[model samples]
Each structure stands twice: as structure tokens, then as C-alpha cells.
Target: MIWYSHVNEDSLPEIVCSTGYNSVIAVAGSGERLIALLDNANLEQLFVVDTNMSAIELLKLKLVALSELDVEDYLRFIGAEEMSSRERMRCFIKLQNKLESSTIIYWSKNHHFIKKGILYIGQYEQFLSKARPLLKWFLGPSFMKVFNNDYNSFSKFRWKIVKSVFSKKVSYLLLGNKDPAFIGKGVDTSLITNGFQELIDKKEFHKSFMAHLVFLGSLKQMDIEFLPASQNRKILKKIQAKLKNREIKIQFINNDALSFLEDNTSTTFNFNVFLSMSDILSFHKTDYVIKCIKALKVSNKCKCAFVFRSYLRNHIDTDIIKKITALGYKIKDVSNMESTKMYKVHLVEKL
Candidate 1:
């Protein structure tokens, strides 16, 4: 399994909300983040790329659900609420005809996740399920209070409680070690620990949605925007409107990021923008980053946006920026961006 089943990236959608792009190449995690981007923009072509077949299958299931089900039913289906197993099965059956054979076979092989609901299958979601109870037990009722309150006013006692719960010992037991051979391969523990500590130290907990998710399991109590709501109806309405007049293409490719970029060098796929949620730089080396940037056949106005975890801002960001600049791209000032204070947002444009 991949290091992350789903990475909650609220900032990507916000960053590209107004930019009109004809084509987009995005990393597919839980598929929710990409869907959020799609909800805000209408593109001529969308390529959802990922190395994990399971991740691709998950994205396909989501696409089918969005196409077939209404917003409410789609929410219910993914949320696993107000629907029985049989009803869910019926929903899947209805969608199967509308999906490709490959998708159908993949879903059939992982029918358990389908019957149980797709949202519950990710490694991150499963980890949260186990950690939530522990968090509640350790923090007690005060957890909800602190989570809901203002971060600036978060008492010292609250910080102490958070620090105690997120200690090295607890993190090791909860998140496990950073061994690539493990099930959750190639994760940077500092991305979680040091990142959280930085947020708390800076008193930016209120702005750190990822931290909230790691500690509290949900952002509902955070009293701020976290993940966007499932905009199924909105997307479906747009799709229907488009189908009545023209054709729209959305493709999903199951390949590693480096290989996908490398193989696309000869294609005329004029991707106007690329959005990644810090996975490539965090997991892979600088050489792979250079290859990805080199392989992309982007337009002159193309902008590449990446959200890097705070811990990676020093070395990784410097190396990537140097390579991208060497390739003739100019770095755009990302200081004005909001909702991404927890991360170092990098935006570069092809010169």
C-alpha cells in the first residue's frame, strides 16, 4: 500500500480556483482533492495520475458514483450513511454498467470496500479510526473544547496535553517507523511530528487542518474550513450540461509520477497546470523531481504548484527550485496565498 491512502489537501483547490486551465495533470490520492479541483474548474482534459492501482480503482469508483448518483445519494454512499448494504450494492450495480470493464473488474476484486463504502478503505482513514479513540481517551472532554476554541487562546495546559499525547513514544506506536519496506512505505515521520510541533509552537493550530486531522480525526470541531464537501451534484450538473452540447474527457492513468512524465515527452498533451500534494518531493529524490519537470510538455503560461510539508522547506524546496529554475521556469511569489500557512507553497511558471 502507498504511504497515504488519502491526503487532505484543501489548499490546492483554493490556489487554482480562479485560474482557467484547459488541461490539468494531478496526483490521485483519495481522489477527493482532485474532485474538489474539478468542482471548481471546467477543463477540456483531466489526467488523474497515480502509481497505485488501488488508488486508481478508488478514483474510478468515485468518478462512476459522481456520474450516476445525485449529490445527496452520492454523499450518503461515500459517507456510508442512511443506506444498507443491499442498497449500496444496488447503487454499485447501477454504476457498473456506466463504468469501464477494467474498473468493474477492479471493483469486483475489492468488493468488500465497495459494500462497506469506499471512504472507509484508505490507509489514512483506517489509521484515524484507530487513533481517534486513543485521542479522545487521552484528551478527555477537553479535547472537543480546545479543538473548537481559538488557537491563540489555547491554554498552556492544552498545549501540554497535546505534547504529551504526541510524544515520540506515542508517535512511534501510532504512526510506526519510517521504513519503506513497511505497509505505509516511505513516510517522513518528521512531516507529522515536527510539522505538528511547528504549528503548535507558532500558535497556528487553528490554521493547521492536517494537524487537526491527525490529532482529532475530523475537522468539524476545528471551527474552520477543512476538506471541501462532496460536490457530486455540482459536478454532475456540469457534466450533464456539457454532454448536451460537447464532449469532455477525464482520464486516469495508473503509473508512477516519474514514469508518466518521462513517457509523455512525445505527446501533444498541452497540460496547462500540474498540481501535486508534496508526495513526490517528500518520497522521491531530487533526480526524479528534475525528470518530472523536464518531461512535462507544458504551455508557456503553465504554472506548477506544489504544497510541501514544513519540514521539507529547507533542503528539498531549495533543490527543486534550483532544478526548476535551471529548466527555465521562473518562481512565482506564493507569500500571498491563504489556507496553506502550514505548508510552504511553491508556484513556478514556465518562462
Candidate 2:
């Protein structure tokens, strides 16, 4: 099952990798960030890796759609606009030839997800969709203000009320502890008891599509525009053209990233230029992540950049910071620049 149908992380890869990198290694969360990078960065190779096979399939489907469909049609096909199952299937037919045999079979078997719009098909997304009404009922008119982005009237008392309802108790009652949403996609519970708390606290609900999805259950046109790669037509078209012309190559690998790095120590490809972890750090302990980082075979001369995010603050503490610095990298906290205030983003560059 798809854990994340939409990526919550912002265009961090595009930002850090824009310093003239020819290739990128990214965790394929929902394919959105990869699309954003493709649109914004000039790259020759992109390695999209994910442990989830479904996530890889979603990325493949998106790539085929970009190669085949126009901006509007692509949007509709992916469930941005209202389109019937039959119409969606028709659109899928156009993309079928471009997809792998396995990907084609996967989508054909799970056509229900496509009919509902691939964008909202994730397990976590569906949980949010189902929970939206209850959230509205619990918060009353204050819920509407989240969508409207009107925080001036949202009082501290109301914030307390909001916090109570969105507490770990209620979330566990609604969605089991195993659910990706409740677990913060593999993060420790204490690290992020309530995923929406950060955005609400930061008063950044208006600027984040993730905030809209968590609070409103659906997206507005403005939210879509604010999203990383959804509505950037000219860039998308340019990327689409380049994709069709075979200028860029994207490969999807379905394997644990740490394992992939550790086992493939002899691989010739150098991941030294750019690596966008995309919150995958939360899945494994800091030491394990360090082991994986150590396993990476990078170019000695080329300056490398590593990007990662954590939900809570000071996740990479003094010891970890010292460890990373010893590895010849300087870490910068660019959390303020992230569109979604839900994460503390770290941009690490080789010194």
C-alpha cells in the first residue's frame, strides 16, 4: 500500500542540488519531489529509491504521464480535477505502453486507487480523508479557518482545544499505532506526537499543502500551486520535453536504502554529488544512518551535499553533529526556508 500519496517535504532537493549537480539520489516518497527536482534542476541522472514497491510504481506512472500527457490532462489523470473512472482508465491506456509490464499489471489490479485519483490513494491520505469530517465537527467553525488561512482570530484557547483533539490518545483510537500517519511514517511517537502541531504552531498553514491535507482533507487550487511540482506548468512542460527527448534518465529502485547502500559498495555509480534522504532518517536510528552514509561510495574530489528532515527539533544533536563534521561536512539548518514547517531540514555539504 502507498504510505505517502503526497510528499510533505518541500523542494529541498531542488534548492541544494541546484548548485550544479548532474545526478541525484532521492527517496521516492510520492514522486512529487522527484518531479519538482526534474522541473527545477538540470540533472543527467536521477536515482529514485524506495523500500515500498507501490511508491516506485506511483513514480513510474507519473513519469509515463509526464512523457505522454499535457499539463491539464496530466493533472486530471492524476486526480487533480474531477474525472470519472472510465475517463481515468482511458488516460491510463495512453500511459500503459510507456510503463513496465509489472507496473501495468499492478495498476490494472488496483484500478480502484486510480479511479479515486492516484494522488489521494495512500493509506495515510485515506485516513485523513475519512477523519476530516470528525475534525470539523470537533473544531466547529475553527476548522474552516485552517482552510481559509485566517489565524488572526484563532485564539490560544482554541489552539489548546485543537491540541487536545489531535493528541496521541485520539489519533491512536482513530488510526492504529501502525498506521503511517499515526507513526509519522516511521518516526518515534514522542518525536512527533501530533504531526500537524508544528504547522499550526508556526502559523504556516496557508503556505503548506501538507497543512491543507492534514487539516482540510482536500486541497484548494492555491494549495496545489503552493505544492512542489503540481502546478508549475512551464517547468513541467520543459521537463516533459526533456524526458521525451531522453535527456534525463530516472531509475526507480525498490529496496531498503540502507541495504542498497551497504550491499552495493562496489557499484561504479558515485552518489557523491547529491543525496536527498526525504525524512528517511526517521525510519532508522542515527547510528544506522551513519553506517549507511559511511557505506556510500562518493567521489573524492567532487563536493557532495546531503539533505534530510526530522519532525522534532534537535534530532541531530551535538554528538551527531560532531560525527557529521568529522566526516568533512558542514550542516546548515534551513528549516525556515521549507514550505511545510512540519520538519527541521538539514542541508549538509562536504567541506
- TM-scores, each model vs. reference: 0.78, 0.88
Winner by lDDT: 2
Prediction 1 global C-alpha lDDT = 0.59
Q: Write model 1 residue lDDT over 63-150, tens digit each, in one string.
A: 6786678756775676534567677888889888888898899888876777766766676667667766776676566544545544
Taking the tens digit of each residue's C-alpha lDDT, what string does model 2 give over 1-351? 787776556775456555487788888988887787775445788888899999999989988887899877887888766789899989998788888999999999988888888988887677777666775676677556755777766555665665665554456546533453345534444433244566666666676676666666656545445656644676678888888998888887888877777777886455446777877656665665466567777777666677877663226667887888888778788877776655777777777
Worst 10 residues of 1 by lDDT: 306-315
lDDT (Cα atoms) of all candidates against the true structure: 0.59, 0.71
Cα-lDDT of candidate 2: 0.71
Query: What residue runs in model 1 are displaced by over 4 Å at the alpha carbon?
Result: 2-7, 13-18, 40-42, 80-82, 150-161, 164-212, 215-247, 268-278, 299-315, 333-342
Question: Once model 1 is optimally superposed onto the true structure by TM-score, how far is the C-alpha of residue 1 displaced, in angstroms?
Answer: 3.4
- The model with the greatest TM-score is 2
